[model samples]
Target chain A: MLIYDLFKMALRSLIANTMRTFLTALGMIIGVASVISMISIGEGARQQTLSTISKFGTNIITVKPGRKKTRHVSSDSVQTLLLSDADAIEEHVSLIIGAAAQVYRPAQLKFGNKNTNTTVRGTGRKYAKLANFTLDSGRYFTKEEIISARRVAVIGATVVKNLFPDINPIGQELKVDGNNYLVIGITEAKGALSWYDPDDQIFIPVTTAQKRLFGMSYVQSIDIQADKIEDLEQIKKEIDTFLRIRHGIREGEESDFHVQNSSQWLNSWGDAAKTFTYLLGGIAGISLLVGGIGIMNIMLVSITERTREIGIRIAIGAKKSEIMEQFLIESVLISFIGGGIGIMLGILISRTVSEIGGWETIVSTQSILLAFGFSVAVGIFFGFYPARKAANLNPIDALRYE
Target chain B: MGQLYLNLSSESVMIEVKELSKTYQLGKVDVHAMVDVTFRIDAGEFVAVMGPSGSGKSTLMNLLGCLDLPSSGSYFLEKFDIRSLSPNQLAEVRNKRIGFVFQNFNLLPRASALENVELPLLYGRIQNSHQIARDSLERVGLADRAMHRPNELSGGERQRVAIARAIVNNPAIVLADEPTGNLDTRTGDEIMNVFSSLNDEGATIILVTHERDVASRARRIIQMKDGRMHQDILNEGLIA
Candidate 1:
């Protein structure tokens, strides 16, 4: 039989029973919709994480003091990194742009009777630039302020809201650890992510924090900025070598400091997001499989119901292959139409999630194609047996089937 | 709509059977549906097969229609040996050479009378099938009811639609099994008349029926009894 005529016959039969056709296709619709929306949500989360991490600057590297090793026994963190180490890396490293040594401690701040406990970080003049911090209103502390050990501070958005509400925080006097300091700047808000809130801290001159507040000379950590992203690895190696020599750690021995870059964070988070996408897709794939089985079940019942019809076709000289082709076309048409509607439904679902649920969702072309292709494959896989059964029916027996 | 060929010459045999036999496995018992049945039918001859129920006339119809293979016998349609043809080749023979009408008027219930008639042509991969199917419906005097579904048609009209479907591809022979079995006497006579006129137009027709009145309409009669041919006679004398 001609393929066009076969398709017309199949379409006519399906149209003859519209309600059953829709019900049979419903399984594929739901399966493909869920797969698309799940993948979209996963991709959205990954993009959001990468963007947030990139906010810390991809070329920036952080070095924190690791546990001190004595006789191969690891102990508590030791303050091996100092101001000289930061300065030496900045001056001696070939690809280095600048470095900032930071000392952080929880301190109580009092502003005219109202008080709030906040973390106070003391660093050099280049700290704000290296950390991607922008001033909201006032200027950052100058180099002169850091060298002279002036009691100047930069307040964050959260601290301003808590202690300096109804008043301009810049140029105001804030008392830190019972010592008075002048607030010179207020940084813009950076939303809280995970366990840390960047907008809840205060920045002060490192000289003042070491000499007057903590009375300690060793710094807690160093943040280094490389000129270009491509130079990050080379810069890290240079810093590692310089820091180890400066701390006098012997060769082939564990360094007392740990070096980390933004790329590492990106790689780990990217891997996690990909795994999450696969997990959701796998679960949705099961639903698609079940949908295919549902199609097979319905097809079996349809063939049984149309046994006389099959007999009539066979009597009229229809080949067994033609009978098989007719039923197969019916099933494939159901799934193909279902997949199309499912793509639209899935896009709508993801859009609604992003709008109402306040979570990012990205619907990619690859996911839509994958879901559509899978649904069609399910149709064929499940449809084959029933079609073959119908084709193999004995014409005389089928004609006599009441 | 075109002139059908008159193969009235005795040398052009349309169907030939020699020692045709068929047995069915009914649990542990073997039932012989047809035993050593032999017959010959020429083209353009109207023949009626008459038998009581369980007399193996239905088995003969099946074998003649190329629907069922014989257990141990030889059957030929035209020049092709029926036993030697593959299932696909047999299907082609059935498509182009033989047409069938059933007792129950087994038209596809969902299709209109027009589509039903178009079925054989569709299977034969014939072009201009719609026009040809309409022409066949006109031949059965059902052209006005072409768009009506089977359920909407009366028993007589539905049988006419089945006849239209049978002749749509213009096959070499038309085999009908109890074509008027489900109709009232008046409607049955009407269906028989339609067959008589088609046979007059040089279309070969073979009918199976138990009714003597129906058998009288044919020019030849073959009677079966208990899986064997009891008698074969020319009904022209009775018509005279």
Candidate 2:
């Protein structure tokens, strides 16, 4: 028989039972839709993460103090880091662009009747440049303020909103730890970074916060920047050696601090996001498998129902290959129609999610094609056994079938 | 009476069977359905094979229709040796040159009269089947009911439609196995009239039945008993 005739016969058979055909195709529709939507959402999230990581300065490195175990716990333990270490690294590290020591502590800021708890970080003038901090109002604390340990402070956007929502916050007096300090600047509205809200902190000169608020002289950690992004590793090595020498740690003794580069954090976070996307997509893939099985079951039932018809066709001189082709065409048609509907539904669902939940979603042509191709393959793979059974039927027995 | 002799040189013989026998294997035992059957049918002849139930009349028809192979002996259809033909070749011969009408009027239940008539032609390599199918239905007096499916038609009407389907391709032979078996006497007579008219138009026909009234309609009757041919007789001037 001609291919056109086979297609027409298949189409007519499918249309003769509209409800059954529709129900059979429904599985493929849901399967393709879920697969497309999940993959698109994963792609969108991956792009978002990459863009967010790029916002941070690529050449930045951070050195944090590891927890120290002392022989005896005492209030007068010797400090492992100081302001001199920051100054020494700036002079000795040739690849270093700039460096600053930061001392961080949690404190409550009181302005009039309102009060808000926020982290206060004390650092030198170069800290703002190294960390990509931008001021939204007034100016950062001057170098003169750090040398004199003057009680000047710069608040983040969230601190400005909480403590001085109705009034201008710059140059306003706010009490911190029972000491009064003037807010010299407010940082720009930068969203969350590394799960920490950059908008909920206050910045002050390192010497002032150490002497007046925390009552300590040692800095907590040092932040560094490289002149070239490629020089970050060399710069980190220099800072590590300088810190170890300054803290008087000898060879074979573990250093009290560790240095980390921004790329390391970026890689770890990228890996985590990839795993999360795979896990989510894997869960969604189960639905597609179920859908494929449903298609197979329906096709098998169709073969059984049309057994006599198959017999008649065979008796009327239809070749086995022709019989197989007809059934295969019908199966593929069902899945193709289902895949088309699924693509439309997936697009609608993706748009709805983006609009309602404020989620980032990207629907690509590759995703649509991939989904359609997979459904077609599933149709053939799952439809094969039923088609073969129909083709191989005994004409005499089939014609005798009531 | 004239003695029938084998004509070795006659190319006009439509069917020739010699010492044909068939035994169906029913599990461990073989049931002999037909034994040493010899017959010949010419083109455009109207003949009937008559027998009681289990007398092997249907088995003979099946052999003549090329639906089953003989366990022994030779059968030739239109000069083609049927015993040597494959199953697919038999199906092709059935499609192109033979039409079958079953006792139950085995018209496809879901298809319209026109579609059912077009079925045999669909398998043939004919491109103008629609017009042929319509003409065949018209010949069977079913043109008005061409669009009606089998379930919507009466027994006689369904038989006429099956007749239309059988003849749509202009086959060499039309085989009716108790074509009016399920119809009332009057309806059965009507169906027989259609078959007689078709045979008059130069189509060979073979009717298989146990009913004397039905067998009397044919120009010649061949009787069978216990898987063997008992008699072959011609009617001189009988009105069926």
Candidate 3:
């Protein structure tokens, strides 16, 4: 028989039971929708994290005191770094832009009748440029101010809001730890990253923090900026060697400090995001598999119910292959229609999520094709056995079937 | 036209069977359904096969229809050996050369009369089947009911539709298995008259029935008993 006739016959039969067809197709619709929405959510989160990491400047590297061999070592607990070490690295390292020493501690600030407890970050003059911190008003501290151990502060937006709600923060006197300090600058708000809010801290000169406030000669960490992103690995190697020799750590002994770059953070976060995407897709894939099984189940039942029809066709002259083709086409048609609706619904769900949930969702062309192709394949794979069963039926027995 | 039916009978021999035997295994013991049954049918002959239940009439019909292969037999329709042909080739023979009418009408309940009659032509891969199906339905005096489904037709009308489907392909032989068994006496006579007219137009037909009056309508009668041929009679006086 011609394929056109077979297709028409299959269509007629499927239309005969419209409600059952739609119910069977519902499984496919839900499977594709969930997969698409879940994948979109994962992709959105990954891009957001990557953009935030890029904001830190990929060329920047952070050097913290003590290695990561032991977990949870705070900057105060380990002080193997010094301000001179930051100067030495800045002068000696090739492809290096500059370096800034940093030490932070929680302190109580009092301004007028308002008092707020906030973290105070003490760093060198070059810290603002190295950390991507921009001034909202006024200027950052000068090198002379750091050398003289001046009690100067650069307040963040959150600190300003808390301590100087009605007053201009720059040039204002703020008492920190019972000592008077001049607010020289107010940095731009840099939004929260996971747990820490960069806009909640205040910056001060490193010399004043070590000499007067903490009474400690050692620095906590150093921020190093490189001229180019590609030179980060080389600069990290140079700093490691220089710090190892400066700290008097011999060969085979673990280094006393840790050096991390923005790219490493970018890679780990990207990997984590990819894993989450696949995990969700895998779960949704199971539902799709179940949907395929449903198609098979329906096809089998349809065959049994139409046994007399099959026998009549066979008696008239339908080849076994032709009968098989008829049933197979019926199943494929069901899934094809279902998959089409699913793709549209999935894209709709993805758009809805982006609009309502405020997350980044990307519905890629590749994912759409994959889901569509998989649904068709599921139909074929699951439809085979039932079609074969129909074709192999004995005509005599089938004709006699009630 | 009359020439269409006349052209099919030009070759003379329609079906030839020699020592056709079929055996079935019911559990463990072998059951001989047909023991060396032999027969020959000529073109445009109206023959009746009459037998009681379990006398192997259905088995003989199945083998002749090419729906099943005989256990040991050499059967020929025109020139092609039915036993030597592959399953696909046998299906082609059935599609192009044979048509069947069953006791239950066996018309697809979902299809209209036109579509049901178009089935044989469709399987034969013939083009322009719509007009051909209409012409075939008109032959059975059912052109006006072409769009009526099987359920909408009376028993006699449904049987006429089956006859239309059988002759739509213009096959070399038509096989009717208890074609009028489910109808009332009046409806059964009406169906038999349709068959008689088709036979008069030079169409070869083989009818299987247990009713003696139904068998008397045929020009030739073959009676079966205990899987063996009991009698073969040429009823010249019975032909109208």
- Candidate with top DockQ is 1
TM-score of chain B of each: 0.94, 0.94, 0.94
* TM-score of each candidate structure, all chains considered together: 0.92, 0.83, 0.89
User: Where does candidate 2 clash, by residue pair?
Assistant: none
* DockQ of each model vs. true complex: 0.73, 0.32, 0.72
Encode model 1's per-residue lDDT on A172-210: one tens digit a residue.
Answer: 899998989999999998766556678889999998999
Q: Rate the local accuracy (lDDT) of all candidates.
A: 0.90, 0.83, 0.89
Give the per-residue lDDT digits (tens) of candidate 2, residues B64-170: 87767899988877877887777778878888778888887766677899988888777775898889999999999999999999999999999999899888878
DockQ-based ranking: 1, 3, 2
Docking outcome class, model 2: acceptable
Candidate scoring better on DockQ of 1 and 3: 1
**Superposition error at A110 for model 3 (Å):** 5.9
| Model 1: CA > 4 A from native | A72-76, A106-118, A158-168, A175-180, B1-11, B27-29, B238-240
Best by lDDT: 1
Candidate 2, residue A20: the lDDT equals: 86
Model 3 lDDT tens row, A186-300: 9998776666678889999999999989888888889899999888899999999998998887787777789998778888988998998889878887888899899999999
Q: State candidate 3's DockQ.
A: 0.72
